[model samples]
Target chain A: MSHLTREALARLVDEMPDERERTHLESCAGCRAELAALTDQRQALATLPDLEPGPDAWPALRAQLRREGLVRERRLPGVAAARAAAAMVLFLAGGAAGYLARGPADPPPSLETPSRVAGGAAPVDPAVAAAAQGATTDVEASASEAFMVALDRYMAATDAPPADPAARLAALENIVLTTAEALHEAPTDPIISSYHLSALAQRNAVLRQLSGDGGPPVF
Target chain B: MTDDELVRRAKTGEEAALHALYRRYAPRVHAVVRRLAGDDALAEDWAQEAWLRAFRALPRFRGEAAFSTWLHRVAVNSALQGLRSRARHEVRETVLPDDQAGPPESPATLRLTLERAVASLPEGMRQVLVLHDVEGFTHEEIGEMLGIAAGTSKSQLFKARAKMRESLGSREMATEGKAYVASDA
Candidate 1:
């Protein structure tokens, strides 16, 4: 038998050999060896294990999703309302604390020319600083409130004991910690805000699942 | 739930359904990205990008193919785009010459050797070999994904396999030599 062409061998490797080439393989020792080697190579290639992302991969991807707005940032009206209420409460608490800490006649600490603005020694307008501080406080409060409400709702919704109470608690704790961290680093970033909100919502869903009211944990 | 059901919910912006889909397919997607990018950091970025792109494009996913297939294609595209962009700015790293000359000792060792060889292949050849041989994409599909003709894809695959065979052959010899030296000692 004539020697098989390299093209023919390549075709055989690709599983596209013609009828005549298929017949050639039966009687040809050299071609058979070549074919076997190729098959082995292909098999070795196929058996390469799929690589796994790090265990924290889902949280990273979830953050990306929130940044992209693929997942809803604002899940529930109640959650939002609770966040707002929480922000208001935090503002009031902070204001009262400031008032009590200051002496009765300390002149209310000059609203017009208080120190420490970014990049310069220029005094910030009291009104602008108050607004900025209020916004920051609101964001922090919203994140905190959202998490608490979600946790409270989840606790109320579940009837039976959780299947894995430790894991459930760990997940809740993680959400709280991650939200707190995000708020501390980038309190005003919408992406961080959305991520904070989503984490709470995800925890609520898990709680619902544990309580038998929801379907499954998102992760 | 089936991917179809999950996809439907994901289209409506359901976070749980999207998470379910991600959980189901992320390993496969990460594997493709890792093989294509040949660097863990780049692979992670590419995998994340692929998922984001998939979700953004979800509404247009008409379900013509299996979700896995569609997602794989998306990953391939994502990797290819990153490669193209990187190619434009980054200097190509030189792949070390293959010097070993014997058969591989075992299947497991051969697999590890082959992975190293594949990672060292030139970007174009590596992409063709991976898509064709490892991922089981057809020359036509690879051509479409890489924006090359089918014949070009075939040519690249052939060159890639030849290089892999040479590299693996050398590594096999090196492994045997090491075994012999250890035994003699």
Candidate 2:
């Protein structure tokens, strides 16, 4: 009997041979050995494990989405929103106080040294935490979390008594508003631009002090 | 939700649905692209690009085929396009050196040897071998994806298997020789 060709064996490994080919294979030792080897090779190929992409894959994709305008830039969701609203209120109130404290021709009060807030960390929202965990971009997530922590600490600090309370409050409010605006425009930017956090914390410290809800200063 | 539902929602610009779909199929998509690209770095990029293209084209995906099948085709196309582009700058080179021409070290290591050998294959033959032998794509399907005649796909698979056999056979002999030396010692 004529021997089976390698092509025939290759096809046989992928599919069952026809009756004629099976009968020939039943009697052909060399063909059987070739078929066995090909089968083994195919099995080996099939058993290879799937590989994991680097851990940064999802975040990289998310970054790409932001670049493509597919997704909005990520922010520290719940707490950041609350902090921003509080900052806005303090800013507006400070502005009103500063305006009222100044005479029409009085120069703006000299800027006070920024104060810091200190306290136990606020609980991160579970949903945001879960999202960060699933993101597998822990480094990026942790940096955002750290910034939020700093902002929280600043918000909690005791406010020092201002020599000019109205003007000091007004300046703090301006800083809060400006920082909030910058964060709103570029939430991811704060990861690289930490000054915004410092400014926000300073305003929070002043607001806390004005409200008589002071904690220790972080800086 | 069903894949169809997710695809529909994704088409309507629901990013959550798109992410769900990605999470579901990314492993399989990455596996296919990795085998096709034969490089981990290239596979990740190709897999991501494939998903991006799939997302951009989701509206046109008329649910005639299963989503996985369609995604596989997209990944294959992405990998092949990358290979073709890279081929322009790359000089063709042999996969094995003269000194390492022996058979695999042992039967236990045969699988690893075969995997390395497959990754070392020239692009055309490697695609055919992987699509047919590993990925279970039919010659007809491979031909459609690779834009060649089915006969050419078959011819390539045959040549690919022959080269693999030669390389593997040499390794097997070398392994046997190593055993003999060890036994002698």
Candidate 3:
């Protein structure tokens, strides 16, 4: 008789063969060896190790969950108190600066004037500084410290309000370039893609604002 | 904490509990999703979506099954749904590269070769093969998931095994030829 067909051998990997095929297997060395190989293959496949997804899986998923409101930030008990304390410090310092900058008779500068009033003595660009601070709080809480630091720099570069629009435009251009580079590492990341789009929109707005055109706000 | 406690907290929207569950199950979830997708590029998204669905469905979980079992079923279903959607939208094919030229010298190498072989199988055969042999789902269970008959699942499995054998043979990863013993019988 002939050796069993490959189909027969494959089936025999899991199912028992009929009497004729069993007799054939008893005598046929070739078919038995092939059957053993098939069995081994099955065992190998079943034992394959579980794989972890990309290293950034949690951060990406966390960002998505946060976006969908499926999960909320879980902060330790003291975090809210710390944030409140920081806010109070800022308030007191603002009061001190307003008192020092204007005569005591003058009403505190309108909220609009704070940016300009503080501009002269500001250690950092106020808008950039605030966004850099918020980048940690507003962005993914699970993101690595290095990523947050890098994003802080990116936000500062993209948000700085230097007197020269061209310089600001250059900064926006840098944001676009760097965000694009980040996207190469994580092409489907919503957060990074949003940053890229924001930078592009900001670049267009800056160009339009320079040409005295009305469009997306300069900020 | 027990999965029950974690599930309770996660249902209440406690992010730390959710994180803990993810840490516990992500590797297993990713493995199943990756095999189902047969593509690394799509696996991550599908795994993430599986977790999203699980989180969304936690409140309705009646605790009829183990948390890992429920999560596994969720991942399988999520990946199957994703594959079906992709099939409706596009006709994509996975072209496996030429097999490596030498006999695999290590168990790790053989495992890698087997993984590639499975990933490269035709969609139907690969799915049935993975769900049945690899994931240890019975044909009845696979039939329910794939909307096919159990007999059809078996037929596809046999075909998948034969094809997988040929794949391994081509890679020289199959058993030593003709070292004859019915003892293996």
Compared with the true structure, all predictions reach lDDT values of 0.63, 0.61, 0.68
Each model's TM-score?
0.56, 0.54, 0.61
lDDT of 2 by residue, A151-208 (tens): 4333332133324554555555555554565466555654313545655676677667
**Model 1 segments beyond 4 Å from truth?**
A1-8, A15-31, A74-80, A83-219, B91-109, B170-185
Model 3 docking tier (incorrect/acceptable/medium/high): acceptable
lDDT of 3 by residue, A1-219 (tens): 688877678789888899999999899787888887778778778878898778999999888888888885533123222232222223222333333323346553222122222344334434223323433333323222223333344345434433546655665565555556545555675545665676677668778877989775554
Task: Write out the backbone clash pairs for model 1.
Answer: A158-A211, B100-B170, B101-B170, B102-B173
DockQ of each: 0.24, 0.19, 0.29
Number of the top-ranking candidate, with TM-score as the measure: 3
lDDT of 1 by residue, B72-124 (tens): 98998998898988897873443323453234466445445666778888889
Q: Looking at model 3 chain B, which ten-residue stretch has the lowest summed lDDT?
A: B176-185
List, residue by residue over B1-185, the lDDT tens digit for candidate 2: 99999988777666677788888888878877877777767777888888778877887999999998898788778888887876787634333333433454545454456666787777899999989877888889889988899999988997787667655653332232221111100
RMSD of 2: 14.7
- Residue B180's lDDT within candidate 3 is 14
